[model samples]
Every structure is written in C-alpha cells, then in structure tokens.
Target: MEPAAKLDPITETALRSLHDIVVPAPVSWWPQTWGWAVVAALLVFAALLVTLRRIKRYRANAYRREALTLLEGVADKLRHPATRPDAIRELAEVLKRTALAAWPRDEVASLSGDGWVRFLDAHDEDRTGDTLERLLDDFEYHGAEIVAGLPSNVCSDLVIAARRWIEQHVSA
Candidate 1:
C-alpha cells in the first residue's frame, strides 16, 4: 500500500478554518397564523357542544332507564303462575307511573281503560297498544281466575309490548 499523503501547510490551514454547519432552531408548536388559531378554537367549541348535548340527552332519559328496570322485575314475576295476575297489575301501574313522569299529570292521571291504552299507543313508536289492550283494560282489575284464563303467550307479549313502550315512547 502507498504511504499516506501529507497535506500542504496552506491546505491544512484552509481545512481547519472550516466550521460545522449551523442548525436552525426547532419549529414552534404554535400556529403560524391567526386564522389557524381561530379554526382550532372553533373545532374545540364544536366538540364541547356535541359532548354537552349527549350528556343532556342521557340525563333526560333517566326515567326510561328506571322504567326498564321496573319492567324487568315484572317480567320475572310473570314467569311464575301464582304471581302472574299481580305482576300484570304491577306492570300496568308501572306504565302509568312512567307516563306520568314523562307527561303532564292532567294528561296522564285521569286516563283508564281504552283511553289509557290509546294514550300509550300515541306515545309509543311501535303502536303496540293492541297487544297490551286486554292486560291493561280487563285483566289488571280481574281476579286470579280471570287472569288464569289468559293465553300462555299473553303474559310474554304484554311484557314485550311494555318493554317496547318504555324504551321507545316519546315524551310530551
């Protein structure tokens, strides 16, 4: 191998005079323009609005959630033959109380029989008033002997209709 070449005195002096390249300062995290800051603020404002609307809606439906829980208890009672009649009565009461909670008392308190069922249908999105007719109108007030005469699916259908109404009824 050839021996390393020695740099001339003038070339060595020139090389030593060269310094490292200068690095620019890091870019700032703040926006470059006022318009970009305005856009960012608008986005944050819109997000806060959407979040507040969702929270308000959830709070407004607290009664529906409570009614659903009561319906579940009635459904459990409906499973037993002995409790079926009383459960039907309780289910009707639950519907009435739920309606009272969502609507004015003058509109819901005095309703009974067909009027009550009609009120329920008017509020229910599914219009399941027919399914709840007999249970709410007659059987709710009848003795255990009358309730025992109901078709086997009647209790379940009533429960389902009640659940649907509780979940989907519109408030006044």
Candidate 2:
C-alpha cells in the first residue's frame, strides 16, 4: 500500500462509528441538597410565631385569670352552712382589689363608699351598679352574718354581680 493510503488506526475507528456529541442530561432541579434545611427553618419560624402569640394572650389575661380564681374561693367560702358574717366584707375587698388590678392603682385605691360603687358601674354595661351599691350599703350594716341569716337570694345575687364586674372589666 502506498504510504499515503495507509490510514491512521484512530482515524479509521472514528470514521467507522460516528454520532451526535453525547452531552450529559441537564441537571435535575428537584432533590436539592438544601431543601430539607429550608423546610426546617420555615417550620421553626412558624412555631415561633405561634408561641409568641400564645404567650401574649396568656399575659394579657393574667388579671382575669387571677380574679376568677379569687372569686371562686370567695364563693366557696360563702357556700358553707356556717358561713362567716365577714364574707360580705371579703367580697367587697375582692372587688376593690380586682378594681385596683384592672385600673391604675392610684385611680382605684383611693375610691370609697359611693365613689367606689360608681367607679365599678363606670365599666358596667349592665348598669348593675345601683344594686351593687345597695348591697354594699347593707354590707356595712350586715357584717359576718351566716348565709342563712341574711336574705340568701340577695346575697347570692350580690356574689353573681361581683363576678360580672370582674369578668366584664375592660382593662387588665
């Protein structure tokens, strides 16, 4: 064979089999390395937001929670067969303390007699203030008498009214 006719072995193989350039398939976008971390971060952020909201709600109602607990204790005391005469006074003290808690201490701490009753009704949407005032008037006269000694219905009504006052107050 003429030297010029002798084919290079590599060139001969390339000529025997030929196809389009074999480009690798494009990289898939899914199954990313950082996806789980991103999801975990979002979940943590959402949990933080919910936790903050729960904490805020609990703090804002702390006074209401405390007042209700105190009222329940007073009611339990008044429910006994040999209840003390001072339960009325106790209820009055609870009301005053609740008022002081819900409002500026300076505003409610100095209130007395009718002024105190009026202050209570100031926040009362039901206008039970007059009745509460009458009850308070009776309180001064009625010291720690047993629940049976006084008009039981009236005393019970007073307790209910006091509950409403604490529950319905606009502020903490």
Candidate 3:
C-alpha cells in the first residue's frame, strides 16, 4: 500500500529547484587569508629592523661624545704646568685605556714595538708627535720612568695632540 502523502508534479519540481539553490558547495578562503597575514607580519618585522639600526647608531654616537669629553678634560689639566709628571703619565694611561675601550682591547693592548709607534704616529699632532709615544713606551718598558718629572709644556702639548686626534677620529 502507498502512503497517503502524495506530492503534486508542480510541488515536486519547486522542491528540487529549492534544494539545488539553497545548498552551496564548500569554499576555501583560508589560503588567501594566510597570505595577507604573512605580508602584514613582514611589514612589522622590517619596521623593527629599521628601529634597531637607528638605536645602534645613536648609542655609538653617544659613546664617541663621552670619549671626546674625557679627552678634552685631560688636555685642559695638562695645560697647568704645576701638574706633576706622574699625573701626566697617569692621564696618558687613562687615554690609552679609554682608546682600547672604544676600540678593541686585545688589538690595542697587545700592540707594542714599531706597531705601537706607527699607531701613535698616525695621529700626527705636533705636541703628541714623538714625545707622546716615547712617554707611553717608557712607562710600558720601565715603569720607573713614570716617577720622573715631565715638563709642563710637554704635558700641555700631549693634551693638545690627544684632543686633535680625538676630534678627528672619534665619531660625532
């Protein structure tokens, strides 16, 4: 026996049409969305890199400025003839150590002989000329030489040379 419910031909056709229209095929937009997200992430990464480079440059400049100030102060002290040789020697050592800190300690600290001479020679401040190297070398070689008295003028000249070198080589 057939069930009492029977669909008319017109109703059957409409139901079939509605079923096809209402049921859509699945869509895949996940890949497109991920691509856009990746692009945004790259943009953020580039911005951070630029910012870090700028910060590094700023720190380098600051370090150079501080080093210059210290060099200038030492030069000013040297101008006073009353300053003792021991004091001047101490100042020179301070300058050398500061340079090492600015540059590489292993390279500068291990430097000696003519290599050291050339290093100082490259600066070429008249006051700093041969005398500065001699004083430094003497202290390194004889330690006792540090106690010897240094002329006020010599100390002043060394300071002048150091200032000139710092101004020329150090980053602004």
Name the candidate that leads on TM-score: 1
For candidate 1, the C-alpha RMSD (Å) to the true structure equals 2.1
- Order of the predicted models by TM-score, top scorer first: 1, 2, 3
Ranking by lDDT: 1, 2, 3
Candidate 3: lDDT over CA atoms? Answer: 0.62
Backbone N/Cα/C clashes per model: 0, 4, 0
**Reference-based lDDT, residue 123, model 1:** 85
Q: Could you tell me every candidate's TM-score relative to the true structure?
A: 0.91, 0.63, 0.47
Model 3 scores worst on lDDT over the 10 consecutive residues at 139-148
- Which of candidates 1 and 2 is the stronger one according to TM-score? 1
* Tens-digit lDDT string for candidate 3 (12-122): 898887744466678865556778889889999999999999999777666556666776666665555444444565566655665575667776787666776666566
Among these predicted structures, which one has the highest lDDT? 1
lDDT of 1 by residue, 51-161 (tens): 999999999999999999999999988878888888988999999999999999998999998898888888888776888787777788888987866776888898998
The residue pairs in collision within model 3 are none
User: Global lDDT for candidate 2?
Assistant: 0.76
Candidate 2: tens digits of C-alpha lDDT, residues 51-143: 999999889778778878887877776666366355666788888887777788888898987788778888887777866797666664554
Residue 94 C-alpha lDDT in model 1: 92
lDDT agreement with native, every candidate: 0.89, 0.76, 0.62
